[model samples]
Target: MLDLIASLLADKELDCRLDHPITEARAAFNRAIAEKKTGPIKRLLVEDAVLVTGTDSGVISGRDAQVEVWRADFAQAGRFVYVRTPRCVLPSEEEPIVTELGTWVGKPEKADGSEVRGDYTAKWREVEGKWKLEAEIFTTVKSRDALAL
Candidate 1:
């Protein structure tokens, strides 16, 4: 299903070349976050969707539960917003599911907090002609100092 989003990248030409339906759906979810709208974001997930956060590997399981988390984040006065940019999207030949690998960034609304960058993987399923997020796993890359033993 084509996402209800206008475009993921600022350049429409680039999006046309790179974006698949899954990427568009993912982009729509990101757009909803920027727009601070939970309703649109809710429709993008399956009932049993799961999310594994970056850094701590915290899990947010289930669609309603995840939506609630997003609701809380949006409710915050100066919370950071996470934006995901899909680098690769591969559909499974045997199933109606696709895997999306991407990079994400969390930019603070206020200038005080530092920006967070990470990599993420998302599993998407085509449910009744609509693409929905099944699960997403995140990994925050440690700094060179932090990585050193």
Candidate 2:
């Protein structure tokens, strides 16, 4: 019984150890987006990260392309707020990768006060002992008003 208890405790400890860095990376990414800090956001992403935006926006391949798109968007945004809550952080059974599925809401600083709520899935890769976003895809949840229109 003591050995079993010890084994359980060790498993729990391992889980926490693996999860801590991913949680930190997620927080840092969200903070960068909320503060519109381009440098931090770029740093959190892999050099070849891919970002797919909703609303008919085409796939943005490569980190530089993604950064440029965000730069333009942030420039016009008076105040931008982005929120993401991870529904699941699943670790790959075979690879050094994790996938996160989350709900996200973004309110751009627009005079009309438009908001976008959606679900996003992101793939994170452990690169040199750091978790970096490798790719992300977002889909918007249409509001009742949008459906009516």
TM-score of each: 0.80, 0.76
For every candidate in turn, the CA RMSD to the true structure comes to 8.5, 8.2
In TM-score terms, candidate 1 sits at 0.80
What pairs collide in candidate 1? none
Q: How close is candidate 2 to the true structure, as a TM-score?
A: 0.76
Q: Could you give candidate 2's per-residue lDDT for residues 17-134 as a string of tens digits?
A: 2353676788887887766678877887899998888566579888888778767767773655777767656677788898776778777555245667778778999998888999
* lDDT tens digits by residue: candidate 1, 1-149: 11322244323333233456887788799999998999888999999999998888999999999999999998998688888988767677789988787778887766454677778878999999999999999888632222233
Off by over 4 Å in 1: 1-17, 111-113, 142-149
Whole-model lDDT for model 1 versus the true structure? 0.79
- lDDT of all predictions: 0.79, 0.73
